[model samples]
Target chain A: MIQFHNVTYTYNFNTDTCKDAIKNINLKILPGEFLAIIGQTGSGKSTLVEHMNGLKKPTVGEVFVSGQDIWQKKFDITKVRFKVGLVFQYPEHQMFEQDVFSEIAFGLRNNGIAETKIESLIFEALDFVGLPHDILNSSPFDFSGGQKRKIAIASTIAMQPDVIILDEPTAGLDPYSSELLLKKFKDYNKNKGKTVILVSHSMEEVVRFADRVIVMHNGEIKMEGEPRKIFTKVEELNEMGLDVPQILKVFLELRKLGFPARADIYTVEEAKQEFFRLKNLTKGGKSFVK
Target chain B: MLNNMMVGQFFAADSIIHKLDPRIKLLLTFVYTLLMFFIESMFIFTFNILAIIMVYKLARVPLKILIKSIKRMLPILLISAGINIFLIQGETVFKFLGINITKQGLCMVSTMIVRIICLISGMLLLLYTTSPAELVAAIEKILKPLKIFKVSPEEIAIMFSIALHFVPVLLLEAERIMNAQRARGAKFDSKHLKEKLKAYITIVIPLLISTSNRANDLAIAMESRCYHGGENRTRFKILHYSAYDLYALLISLLYVLLLLIFNKLDFFKIVM
Candidate 1:
């Protein structure tokens, strides 16, 4: 598990325009868990995640990643980075190689891996992202937006990091492509038992895919629990300027109309199941009441 | 990472200096730089220094900022001062370690140092009070009359405007590229020089490519948006000189007159 101890980060410290980005945040992230971090813009979600792999260090406290202090004097931070892969927003901008083959090979080459294994790793990553082999020798900049994003992710995956952090991976992507990417993430977590932390604004994606959810407000953790437990508190989430999934909102609205319904239904499948149960109850002249 | 650059950095305020017209500020800076050579006596330069101090106070620029500017230029100041101290022989005033300190050299050096300081302060008054946009506008206005000589002052003004606007954007872009490379384990902060150099090569290659791409994109964007050359283009902001500029002009004229009067005086010369 990765742990945080009284972490606080302030920008422009000791200046007139000093601001507290994150304050006294302490939490533990278990391995192999699909964790979703939801927060408003400027709520310190990015700052907190940047500290996971030593991209940033807390001004007042410490972060221990997998039982080791990330800021140890002798620690090779590059090794930590290899273990915790971070894909920033607009990952396509990270693509700088002349061709897709070199792009995916970039990470492995930097880590001192053998040249013989790089070809196989590149092919495996390409397969994982579902890109055709013909595109390997082509310029990454020539592809469509969704294709470029996949190539960027493939480069990150070639390193085989135990933990992968994706920040707003579905941003600017269509729903179909977004679902495919989410399914890949789910498979990675299930098949490899590796940690997957997703930072996104989509409540639907967070609820549909995340095993656990953490709600943040003004740089502090307002709530954290299993997605089912977290989805039950619709009122509190609304107060934080956040939303539950549309299915959950529909279920809540049905209850408000005087029909008994579950507030924790977060997916379309769950909504369909609830509707089927309601139909069976009404067919026998049974009354629906909260 | 490069965001703290201070070239032409303006201090935002509502003081009289800040309120003066950019053209008037530019004109006054030129006058003060030339006036530095007119004073013939140490006492007059001392009086002039006091006047500058009063003007600086009127501008309300923090002394801390002024100190930082001087500190940034300290090496230039010290080297010039040192060169004068060792060379230029005259009647010796003091002997230290069998080396002579000349009277004329000391007088000339102090005068040089004061003049340099005054010139820099006068230049900084404009930069500290006037924003970069205003400075470029002032330049355009001053050069407008040169159009009779077949000059295109507006084009130069546009160039300067574009340059100033992109400096911050380019710095941020470079930082972003560096961060992207860092995440890929490029090791920019490695202790080994060769490794660090190799890491920088990775960043620089991408930076160059991105810069060219941005340039092409900007050109296309401008063209597609119907950006014509600076011919018959009406300005959005028309600079107007108000009573504040009139008062600044009068004060600058009075200072120039004082320097002209000091040109003939040799009392309190203090050659040493």
Candidate 2:
């Protein structure tokens, strides 16, 4: 489990221009849980997630990972980082190797894995991300935008980290590619049972993929719960400068129109099922409005 | 760790220095630097120090930031002083470890050190008060006259501004790549220089590739907008020299004249 104790981060400390980024954050992230950290821009969601992998340290509090303070002396913070793979926003900028194969292999090499097993690991990660083997020999910079995103992701996945943290992974991709990537993340989370922390702005993606939701406003966590429970409080979230899923909004409007519909449907699939059930109920020619 | 760097960073504030026109500020900076060459005495240097302090007071930049900026130049300051001690051969006033330390050498090193401190402090004051956007605007305006000689000042301005714009972008990219590599267990701050160099190579290669990609994107965007470089382009904000600018220029001129008067009197030898 990853835990934060009264964590607070102030950028440029002791300076007049210092800003309180995240304040007194206390939370725990259980292993193998798909948690989505949702907040508007500049709400400190990124700062909160960046602490999980030791990219940043809390100024006023301690962060514990698996019963040990990772920032303490002699803890091998780099090893902690290796176990918690962090894919930053626009992670494609991390691509360094000439070919796609080498790009993916870079991580494994850092982990000091044997040369004989590195090739297979690279292929497994590529296959996981649905990247073609034809681009293995070509320069990684030669690919299309979506393909580059996949290759960059594959570079992180080859490490087989215990916890994979992605910051706005699908912000710039096409709809189909984003959906494909989200599905891949779900498979990674379920099949491998690794922790997946997705920092996103899209409530729809959170509703579709995440099992738990964290809502943030300013520099504090406003609420946290299961997706269904969190989306049910539509007014509270909207007040924090965030919107619920479109389906939830649609259902809320439907209820206002006196349809007696559920206002907490979070995903398209859930919306479809609810609408079909409502359609069948109305087809009986009995008064279902009550 | 790179965040501590204060050189070329703007400190947002509303002060007399910040209110001065950037074009006038740039010109005054140039003139002040030229005047530093004629200061031959410690008294003149002392006066320059006072003048710099007064400028800093007007700029309202915190002393902590100035110290941080000068700290980055500490190594250069020491190295210059060390080398000058041996290079300036004259009447040897003292001996240390069988090496002669001349009176002239000591004078020159002190002057050099003071000059560097003043130069850096003055330049950082300008940078601290003037935002990068304003700096670029000032440069484009100052160099506008070069267009008559087929110099293409607008293209030069565009390049300058783009390069300035990329400093922070690339710094953030480097941090991202650094973190990504660190997550992969790449030891960047190894004890051995060779190991550190190798690790840097891993980070720099990607930065280079992304730079090319960014340039291509910028070119495409510019072309789409019909950017044909400096042909009858009208600026949104025209450069205006107000009474404050005139006052600032006259003050700078008076300061330089004081330095000349002090140097001619050989008044600093009393302190020496």
Candidate 3:
């Protein structure tokens, strides 16, 4: 539901140390799609996602959300933000309310949602993030880091924006919590049919959940396609300081050894299926095994 | 908006002022500011302004950047000058909107503005030429004598440097928190004062929380690294005074002498 046309953003503009954070970005996000943006550090992933919610206006081009130009004169930017929720990196540090209930209700209240409906929405968000209802009265700061991250996510999801953009949502979390959190976002996108744009560094997570992947390097979009297609260019990705999933690396090694295994196998499940299929082919007696 | 803050910011350049000893620069700035208050004549003020302009040229700092730095103080300057124009009572030279504008008021306002400008420019010149580390070292050197009173100049200097280093970090954090609040639909640009205050509350609470959290983490990290309050620690770069420092001190002494001479000369003095 968000589109960027020739968007270029420069930080510290008009200063001697001015830098182009993102340059000449032309992108489009479809409704209900799980889009993952992968890049090295300072590769403009955060800047690109920040533009989706109009948090950072592009210095050069136009960003359109749901067919409306967000930066147009007289356009209400708050409205755009309400429709496109952004969960910043280290979002738990942005928590301010005294308790979990008020913390989750903060966005709903700011968006002028009905007072009576805020409680229900907060409960719904807590449910979505797997937080319990009993801890609503407790202070958010008293929770563990993962719980705090869930509370932060609940705070954003309470607003129920049509498009949710998360910048490194799973950063600093354990692997299990990261996977669980990504699953929640997947459920949110699948069940609600809402657009989800994730800025991530994990190739495995992107290959697992992302319907489309966009690789960024040096303030420009380097590649864009399905995960399988994107992972096929392992050398190019490595040159840009990015890596493919481990399963794909194994399959690539098999291909190099004269085995006919598929090189595009990303997830472990796909690798298992490919292994069985190869075993079945080898069972014909004329084996191609190295 | 916070990026416009030029206080404590250094502009790196290869110039005589930038190469001079930081201790000398600090002392000269303090002495120049003191001398600025002793001036009683327009001629001395003009002379000080010319001297400041010459120093600016010697420092090789761009004129536009200097003007931009001064522009941030325009509101305070105008407000103070406006108050002086209307409130100071003397011979009424003119009237505007039923308020008398006195000649003494005009003279006092001019002197006040000149003095403030000279003081600010002198401080800014010192900051623009000297890096923060050097400034802290110079401060420690100046306060070294206080060691006799059970004070640790090294610890104070480390604290000062840390405080200076965190200013930009906190500003960046504040900006991030502000954007996060805005993304939550908080309207910071509202015209109502109450709404604006409410918006800022969201930013302030988060900023304070993060600041303390950061401080705690930094303390732990320092402890892990065996940091022991700067006792018996060696420095990487030691401060040294050269011939240029002596030259700078002599020039400032001459400038102070000129100010004293002009204070004695009543021919160019303006009666307030």
Interface RMSD of each: 1.6, 1.3, 0.7
RMSD versus native structure for model 1: 4.4
lDDT of 1 by residue, A254-284 (tens): 8887777877788888889999987887898
Using all chains and alpha carbons, the TM-scores for the candidates as numbered come to 0.83, 0.91, 0.96
How many clashes does each candidate structure show, in the order listed? 0, 0, 0
**lDDT, candidate 3, B130-201, per-residue tens:** 999999989988999999999988889988998999999999888899999999988899989999999999
**Candidate with better TM-score, 1 vs 3:** 3
Q: Model 1, which residues run further than 4 Å from truth?
A: A284-290, B32-54, B69-121, B146-159, B191-194, B204-237, B256-272
> Candidate 3, residues A104-196: lDDT per residue as tens digits?
998898888999999999889989888889999999999999999999999999999999999999999998889888999999999999999
Clashing pairs in 3: none
The CAPRI-style docking tier of model 3 reads high
lDDT of 2 by residue, B1-272 (tens): 65544276888888988988999899888887777787767777777788777778888877877887788899989998998898889999989888999998998899888888888887888888988878888998788888879897778888988998888888877787887777666779788898788789888988898899899999999999998777688876676778888888888888778778878878665444
Candidate that scores best on DockQ: 3
Q: By lDDT, who's the top model here?
A: 3
Supply DockQ values for each candidate.
0.48, 0.73, 0.83
Rate residue B19 of model 3 by lDDT. Answer: 90
The per-residue C-alpha lDDT of model 2 at residue A11 equals 91
- Report residue A260 deviation for candidate 1 (angstroms): 2.9
